[model samples]
Target: MSVVIPVSADWLTLREPADAAARSHSLARRAARLVHPPAVVHDLGSGTGSMMRWLAPQLPAPQTWVLHDWNADLLAHAAAEPPASVSDVDSRVGHLEHLGADDLSGASLVVTSALLDVLSADEVEAIVAACVRAGAPALFALTVAGRVDIDPVDPGDRLFEAAFNDHQRRVAHGRRLLGPDAVAVAAELFRAAGWSVRTDASPWRLGGDPALVGEWLEGWLAAAVEERPALTEWADEYARTRAAQLAAGRLRVAVHHHDLLAWPA
Candidate 1:
C-alpha cells in the first residue's frame, strides 16, 4: 500500500501563477543548453501538465512531452491543455517505480515539480538510477523544505508548523516519506552517481489572494491535527483566526522550497 495524496485539478490551477514565479530561471537555461532542437521531455508526476506549461516556452521550440501520472483525471486534464509550443503531447499512467531507462529513452530532459517530498528515500533512489541509466538530465523543482513563515504571527503558528513537518515525515504502508529532507538527499544521491547538481531556493511569497491562502491554510492545519490528535483544539482556534485575518486581507505567507538541476558528469 503506497501513500496516496489526492490532488484536485482546481488546486493545481490556483497555484500556477505562484509556481511559475517560484521556478528557477537559471536552471531552465542550463537545461536548455544540453538539448538540441525538437527536445523530447518527460515530466514525472505531471499533475495537470503544470511543469510543461511553465517550462516549455523557456527552452527552444518544437518540443515533445510525455506526461507521467497515476491519476487518470490529471492525465486527461493535461492531455486536453498542452502548450502551443509542444509539437506532441503524450500520457503514461503508472507509478514512478515503474519508470525505467526504456521509458526515458530518447528523452533530452526529465522534469517534475512539487513532487519530491512525497517520495520515500528508496523511491527517489530508484528515480535517480533510472535517470542515470537513461543518461538524461533532470530538473526537479519546488520540493518543500518544511519551512513556512506567516506574518502577524500567532502563538499557535510554530506548534502547527512543527506538527505539519512531522506529518510530512510520517510513514505510510511501511515506507517513510522524505518530506523536507528530500532536496538534500536527492542532491547527495545524484552527486554520488556522478551527476553535476545545482540547487536554488524557490519559496512562494503569497499575498493578496485570500481564497488561495484560505484553502492552503485549511490543508496545512488539517494535516497537523491529523498527525497529532492533541493539536485538534488549538488547531481549530488557529484555523479560525487565520481565516479571519486572511479574509480581511491582513495575511501573508512564505513557503520555502528548493529546486535542483542534475546532469551527467
Candidate 2:
C-alpha cells in the first residue's frame, strides 16, 4: 500500500535534493551583474528561506534579507536562522499580494524561487509592478510553466507534461488566463512594467540521483495531470507506467526552466 501523506504547512515547505543549493548560487551569481552592492533583498513567497541560504554568500557584504510568506510556520522556519554570515535579516508573515512599494522601499533586489507558476498572470504582474516601483532589480528563478523533455525514454512523457503545463496557464487569480507559456508571459509582463528582463532555463535531471526527489516529482506532475478531465485517460496511463518505472528503480527527471532576472528600467 502506498503511504497516505498528510498535508500540512511545514511538510509542504520541505525541499528535495533536486532543489540543489548550488543552483541558487548560480542564479545569485548571474544576478550580481544586474544588482548593486550593499542591497536590501526580498524573497517573495519565501517558504523556508532556502534561496537565501543558497544566494546570500555570493552577494556583497552587509546583505539584508526580507523573507515573505503567508504561513507563520514557514516564516518561523525561515527566521530560525538568520545567517551569522548575513549582515541583517527580517521575516514578514504576510501574503505577497499585500506587498508593495512601502514594503520594499529600502530593498534593492528582489527574488523568488519555485513560486511564480503557482500564481496567475495578473498577480505576477502586480508583484512585478511593486518591485519595479520600489526600483528593485528582481530575480525569479525555478518557475515551472514550461516542461523541457529531459527524460525522453518515459513512454507517457508528452501526454503527462502536456496536461500539466496546460493546467499551469489555465487560471490566474480565480479566473482563467494564458499560462501555458508562464515564463514567457512573466518576462513580457516585466518588460511592460519597465523592467529590463533576462531569462534562462534550469532543468532538474532526476537521473543518477536519490529516490526522495523522484517521489516528489512524480506526485507533483501527477497532481497537475489529474486536474483536468480532458486529460484523465492519458493521465491514468502515464501514472501507471511512471509508477511502475519508479518502483522498478528507473529514472524520472523534471526540467524546470528558470527565468534569471528582470531588472528595473
Candidate 3:
C-alpha cells in the first residue's frame, strides 16, 4: 500500500532544498569579491533570506539586507528574525516580474539563489539590465541552464535529467525553461555589455542522504519523462525503476551547476 506524505510549503517549492543549504554557503564566499563591505544587499526572491544568511556575515559590518519575495509568509520568515550583525532588514512583497522598476535604489549587491531558472528570457535580460542600472554586482546562483554534478558515476542520471529538462522547456508560458546553457552564456550576456563576470561550481549532492527528497525527485522526473508521447515507454521503465528505488531507500539526488558572480561593467 502506498501512503501520501505531507511536504512543507518550502520544500514543495524546491526539488533540492538541502542543496541550497549545503552548497550555497561556500558559493556565497566566492561571490563576495564582486560585492564589497558595508553593502546594501538585495536578495531578490530571497525565500526565507537563505542567501542573506549565507552572504551577510562574510562581508563587512552594518550590512543592510533586503529580502524580496511574493510570498508574505516567506518575507516575514526572513524579516522577522534577521541574522546577527545585520544593520537592518527590509522585505519586498511582490511578483518578480515587477522587480525591474521597483525601488532597489541603493543596492550594493543583487543576489538570487535558484530563482533565475523560473524566469523567461526577457525577464532575465530585464533583471540583468536592472542590476546593471542599479550599479551593484550580482552574486547569482543556480540558474537551471547551468546544472552541474560532481563525480556523478550514475549513467542513467544524465539520461533522466535530459528528459526532465526537455519537459521543463515545453512548459506553458515558456516557464521553467533553461534560459541559456553552459555558464559562459550567462557570463557573456553580462560580459557583452562589459560587466565583469566570474563563475564557480555550487553543485549539490546528496552524499548518501537518507531523506524524502528522493521521493520528490522521483515524482519530478516521472512527471517530466511521462509528458512526452515518444518517451512513453522509457517513462514507464524510468518511473518503475525510480519508484522501486524510492521504496527500498536506495535513491539519492545530485544537482550539479554553475554559479554566476556578475556586476555591471
Off by over 4 Å in 2: 1-16, 21-27, 34-37, 148-152, 177-180, 208-210, 230-237
Worst 10 residues of 3 by lDDT: 1-10
Query: Which candidate tops lDDT?
Result: 1
Q: How many pairs of residues in model 3 come into backbone collision? A: 4
Which residue pairs collide in model 2, if any?
120-172, 169-179
Which of candidates 1 and 3 is the stronger one according to TM-score?
1
lDDT tens digits, residue span 70-121, model 2: 7667778777886655777788877665667899988878988777776666
Q: Using lDDT as the measure, what is the rank order of every candidate, best first?
A: 1, 2, 3
TM-score list, all predictions:
0.97, 0.83, 0.80
Report the number of clashing residue pairs per model: 0, 2, 4
lDDT of 1 by residue, 4-87 (tens): 557999999998888999899998999989877788999999989989998998878899999999898999999897788899
Q: Which parts of model 3 are misplaced by more than 4 Å?
A: 1-8, 12-17, 20-27, 34-37, 145-158, 174-176, 179-185, 229-237, 243-252
